[model samples]
Target: MPTILVADDDANIRELVCLFLRNDGFDTVEAKDGKEALTVYTSVHIDLVVLDIMMPNMDGWALCKELRKRSPDLPLLMLTARGETWEKVKGFELGTDDYLTKPFDPLELTVRVKSLLKRYKMAFTQTIQFGSITLDRKTYKVLCGANSLVLPLKEFELLYKLSGTPGQVFTREQLIDQIWGMDYAGDDRTIDVHIKRLRERFVGTPDFCIETVRGLGYRLEIMS
Candidate 1:
């Protein structure tokens, strides 16, 4: 069973969330503050975390950053009273996989937790296959039917990241930080350029396509 760390200042909310998660077949660890949450996280093998933004000792933003630094792929879901667009954007920038405003339904939270876990599992695999295409992260190769093609390092990493979590929209900033590193002092449009190249290269292929999500960033969609 996957272990979930529920960190919130409110004991009632923590208990309620953990109760629902436990009822749905997940083991949970609870912490009333971000400091305790971090300590619990380091000591326990937590598969995912549900955290609130405002807390004593340490806030969710700081905790999120610390956790992301420690475990790049660890799934984080933020629960907060603030539903502002900037808050959501900041959460994503800090490496949160999902966000839910306060007063949310427990059932909705459970569903989101399962979705995040599923996405995390898919991303943890070294190789991912959709239709006729196979992305081998170990060798950095794209195997489509009889052909084995190599992409540029950046392009390959971008594709691998997107394909790892199909339908998950990743902002250009997230892509740059994850793929190009935080110190990458370049224009974000580089992501667009790389996406274009990947699309042109795989245009005739029916396996998947990289989609631009208008105001958002991009997501990989597998062709049916």
Candidate 2:
């Protein structure tokens, strides 16, 4: 199930959003302010974040900026009553993936969340192959020729991201954005950990290498 973080000062707004998300089969964690939101986000694994512009302590923009610094590709949905062009631009500039005005339709919010989840989930699949190893994106199964390799969720996502593009080199930011979704609330350390795990899994496979580009990022080396 997808996890969502809803940050709003109003009790009613938080409840309403939580209800809608729950009905849509999403698990949510709620926060009343930006500080609380950041706390919840850092601790829990959230797929997306719904941030309100006006809030005490941190505010949406500041929090969004912090999130972007850690995970540039993290998915964030900015919520505000302003609805002005500049406010929207600021959110976008701060790395919010989407935006919604206050008093938004519950159905529309549901649809947006569903869409984001679908797009993010597509990054990981149960069936993928990098050289001799084959990954089942759905079942999280990894097969190396006749041998099957076990992978955790993070490892699976990393391999899936790399395998999808074949030889394409993806920056750590790109990988974090693709696999962890936008509102990841995690840092580059998250990407490093997953990459380490993935490399160890394919260590014996001389053909498949997750190449490090120094300052660029990592990529699956495709041998011809």
Clashes of each: 0, 11
Model 1 lDDT tens row, 1-224 = 99999999999999999999999999999999999999999899999999999999999999999999999989899998978877877887788888899999999999999988888898999998888788898898999898999999999899999988877778899999889998999999999999999999998887888888666678898889
Error of 2 at 168 (Å): 22
Superposed by TM-score, candidate 2 places the C-alpha of residue 200 at a distance from the truth, in angstroms, of 44
Whole-model lDDT values for every prediction: 0.91, 0.77
> Model 2, 211: alpha-carbon shift in Å?
35
lDDT of 2 by residue, 97-204 (tens): 667898799889988877656545544544655557777877788888898777878787787777665544566666676678767887877787778877776777
